[model samples]
Target: MKKDSTMKRVLKLLKPYTGFIILSLIFALGTVISTLMIPVLEGRAVDHIIGKGKVDFSGLLFVLKEIAAVAAVTFFCQLFMNLINNHITYSVAKTLRQRAFERLLRVPVKVIDSESHGDIASRIVTDADSFTDGLLLGFTQLFTGIMTIAGTIIFMIRIRFTIALIVIAATPVSLLIAKFISGRTYRYFTQQSKDRGDLTEYIDERISLEDLVSQLGAGELSKEEFVKKNNKLTDSATKATFYSSLTNPSTRFVNAVIYAVVGVVGAFLAVAGSISVGELTSFLGYAREYARPFNEITGVITEMQNAMACAARIFEIIDQDQVEDCDGEFDGEVKGAVDMEHVDFSYVPEKPLITDLNVKVNPGEKVAIVGPTGAGKTTLINLLMRFYDVNAGSVKVDGRDIRTVSRNALRSRFGMVLQETFLFSGTIRDNLTLGKPDATDEEIIEASKAAHAHEFIRKLPDGYDTVLSPSGTLSQGQKQLLCIARLMLALPPMLILDEATSSIDTRTEMKIQDAFNKMMKGRTTFVVAHRLQTIRDADMILYMENGHVLEQGNHKELLAKNGYYAKLYRSQFMS
Candidate 1:
């Protein structure tokens, strides 16, 4: 999006806080009026002391008191304005962050899977922070600066119109300089934000896989890649800073010229007896006040440019196409009969993966799917779960199209345990009760025992209350066991086990396999496994290759046929 468009969207976010903004503007005006009074009062006091001998003491004393009162008013007004600015800054930032996160949850899973996770995180956290900083500066300085300039001009024109005209004529020169310099910095700041995201993504990716990097002895290589990204970020930041930094000094130079010109003209006017020394004094002060906002605004423009760039990145996520779900709920109990009719799907449209694939499995049947890597094994499971919709056909459960049902209702019926395990940073009880929050203690124990996790849980320092993180002390097999125990607690009518025992040892695998056999008795089960021995007793075995079911039959039948499944079966058993 363009800068102007991004700014308009940001303004919409602040619409709810218009009351605070109006109050701030009110105080800003009060501050400017009080500040303008000081110079006028000070000029009056100077006139009161006429060549030391002919002094107007009462007039001088009264002007000094007025100056003191106005100064106090200015301080209080400024203090209140600053408080309002801070409130507006952080509140808008919080709103943006909350909206960005809500969008993340609503958007399609493919949208998230396609983007860099670290970059998305940066936009929500780091970019929001930068935007707030710029916003705060704009609120505190930009508004006040503009007001001060206007007030100073009115005061100066009252004192002497000619001098005010000179200052006004030079005003556009300072503004043109600021605009020219600030315009060039936007692209640089944009590049800087992107580079920072790239660096963050690289760091998060490398750190998350530190164990693999160490095992492969690629630590040095990883460091080198990190350094490359870091250096690139540094270059972009330095260049952006270099360009933005020019605005302040450039405007300051033009302001100083205006200040000098005002002083020279005021002195000539004073000599000609057209204006008093007191009025000249006030005019010089007004000239300084008028020029000051130009400098401050130029600096604010620099930060505003950076803020707009970050905001554009944040809005990109918020504006993504959300995953659409129907309002339909299941009409009756789900019986786990699943069928895929002429289903076609591909991650990328140019390269088709699963095409016109068909599958059917009745309720209470144990179906095993075996395939090599990249043979669309996991992709099939994804289709069934409705993580991605089929491009050409329908996936049906209990003879109704799955897409017609709400995603939450459809997913809640299946219990799945995949190869990779994820444990939140909470007590084991919290993680176990996620799917069934109202599960009783007895039920938790029973599920744990069934998954062979109870013995290990009992050995922990706090049993089920022990906290666990993804990088906690638990081993891979232990975490996988906990995942199984979680599914057991839920006990959905259908099950999908995708190498669920891949992390466990042979002994544990045997025990878990027995437990799974008992669990699979009444429910329809789909098992995707690389180890052929684990699925020998399945009622039907599907051998898939390149998204097509090459052969499917029970162990005896496929063996008799001497097909692909038999060849795969012999490799594992006879090798």
Candidate 2:
């Protein structure tokens, strides 16, 4: 589907903030009015002071005092405009951030995993910041600049209509200049935004692996690599900045020409006695005022180019296809029987992972899926969790087709522990209670003991309350233990363990297995393991290869058969 362009979407984002915008317009109006009156007042003072005989200081003084009053009004108006600017800018940025983050949460796991972590993080923060800084200030200046041009045109016409036409005629040239410059430069700004995102991702990746790099003693090598990336970023920025800088000076030149023309033409009319000296002065002032907005607008045009580039990226995320929503309702309580019927699946459709596959397990069965690397072990697990839907056919959990089940409702019945452990930044107790937020302290301890994590957790300074940073705060094995404890606390009707005990010591794995055996009486469990010994006692074992189940039986049956499973088992243990 064709998405709306960035400029159109950004204008749409401004709709909710209209009230703040209207208030800013009010302030802008006041500022422009006060500002335009200055030229008229100064023209009067000039005429009064330069009169033939008497200085007429009294009249000049009155004009000066009015000028002071208008200046004061202008100052207050500008101050209010700035306040309004901040309010609108910050509110818009906040809404964009919230929208981006909420979408981030609901996007498919595959989509989220495909992006660089740093690039995603930068879009939520750095891009939004640029959008706010550029658009807010630009809108503010745009409002005042446009109003100034209109007000000056009216005032100048009152002084002399022909000269006013002259001022208006030259305005389009300034616009033409802007259009030409921006066409050449806008793409560079877009490229610069992309390059900066890459740089952010590179730095973030480096920082995340800082400990490993330090241990490797490759700090200097890392520095040299970073400098190369930094140079690419710098070169792009310099090119973009160079072009945007041209906007102001080019417009200024056109404005200067307009100012000079008004002066010369008005001087000729003054000599012919067609207009008063005071009126001619006002006409010259209007000429300068008329061209000023174009100059300012071109300058803002440069900034808006960058802002529009940022807005485009934000829109790309907003417009991605979201994870499919489940519309089918299943009111029955889950009994944990599962079926994969004639399932066809693939991560990328061209390379099939499973073909016309079918599998069934009764309630409370201990099923182990054993396979070599790239044997579709984890992919099969993903289908059960509804992380990725099938290209053809369906999966039923407790006789309810999972595609019709809301992801939340379907996933709620399963507890999972994968090979890669993840823990949020919080206390160990807090992480344990995540699945069952209402779990009591005693419940936490029970689950931890089941996973054999309680002993080490108690030794920490604050016991279960000990805080953990995002990763590497605890040993990999300890992190894995916490994950198991979390799954135990949830006590879901079904469980999936994907190499869940790979990091644990043999002794610790034995204790956790005992806990699992005790809990497995009436609950269904699916274990994916490469360590054949881990699933030696599974009630039903399926040995798979190249996305097909080649064998199924208990461990002894497979070993006696002396097939592929037997060979893999020997490679790991019998050898």
Candidate 3:
């Protein structure tokens, strides 16, 4: 959606808070009315003293008591309304944040890959937080300020209409100045948000690759790049701050001019005997009271516009198209037959990653895809998982198109173990039972034993309850073993092991291969690996080059053929 329309949509989310807004305005009206009474009562006290030789002490005391009572009531009303506004605001912010996070979870993997992790994180945290602040404080202040200004205007006119006209005349001029400054502030704020997202992306990229950066001696270059992004963010923030800060002092200057004009005109009317001394004094007090609301109104206008910019940014993310889930009833089970027929796929439109790909795996068969780097091995797995749809042709399991099945149901049928393993900050048991949440402690330990992880976990200080902090603790091979244990607990009907054993030492690899053989006994499995000896006994071996199948056969037959597969096997194992 366009930024303006997105902002309007965000405002619509606040419609449920209208009742609280009305109550706040009502409180503001009451407060403004009560404040007007003080000046009138003062004028009356002065008149009573001047009219008679003696002061009316009883009348004076009664007026003072009424003023105190009104003051106390007004204070409570403001406090109560503020508390309500805060509650309403917090509820709305919570709802918005929850929706944003849920949407992120449901979005397609392709959509996630298209944007940087840091950029998405910034939107969820920084942008949404700014939107919350603007929605609550900005909207409440704006509504109340408008009410106060309107109520003050009516009372000031009642006191002395001629002096009231001078204050009213300043309204248009104040609005014009506010409008001019708001345009600049809004543009600067938008730029600032974009720049901040860029800076966050840069930092995330650098930190994740810190070890590689140090190895390459690129520290100086990384620092220079970071400095450039930081400077851009600083410049944009400075411009936005400068423009937004102009609001207060500019409005104050205009108020000062209005005050001088009203004073001169009010004195002239008093001198001509058209107005009493008490009336003129009350009129000046009304003028000052009138300025207070107008100043508030101006400040609210400035703040709301600034908040609108933030709202626009937050809505932009919410407005983007998320992956549409295929509609169906699913029971999270599937027959293991797999097929890819005449499939063509691409991450970019102009460059095809896989072309005219045709492959099939019978139920309970073990197949290995052997390929060099960038030969579309992972892309094929991604397509089978429906992370990205094939540009042409179809992928099917048990004669049913994968796209026809709901994503969750289709994904639940398969387990995956990748080369690079990630262990979240938690107990070893917590990581093991992630997929099979309902599994018993016995089941978890059994799976861990099958993956050769239970013995090592038992050796830890806290055994299975040992907590692993992300920054310290586990070695790379140990993390891989934990992930394998997680996949074991899942026990899906089909599995994909993409270089799963490559990270471990040769001795550990042989141990894990024994576990893998046991796990694949009756399940369909797709193994993608660079090692020639890993898949020497597979049911079939597919040698792929530039997305095409170069050879296909059992390992011994392929080596006997003296073709591309033979050449590759000789280069590695026969060396």
Per-residue lDDT of model 1, residues 16-45, tens digit only:
999999999999999999998988997898
Tell me, by lDDT, which candidate is best.
1
State which candidate, 1 or 3, has the greater lDDT.
1
Q: Which tens-of-lDDT digit does each residue in 76-175 have in candidate 3?
A: 8778777877887777767777777787777778778888778777777787777667666664566656666676678678877777887888878877
Between candidates 1 and 3, the one scoring higher on TM-score is: 1
Q: Where's the lowest-lDDT run of ten residues in candidate 2?
A: 1-10
Which ten contiguous residues of candidate 3 have the minimum total lDDT? 326-335
lDDT of 1 at 73: 99
Pairs that collide in candidate 3 are none
Model 3 accuracy (lDDT, Cα): 0.80
Q: How many clashes in candidate 1?
A: 0
Off by over 4 Å in 1: 51-61
TM-score, candidate number 2: 0.92
Give the winner by TM-score: 1 or 2. 1
How far is 142's C-alpha from truth in model 1 (Å)?
A: 1.7
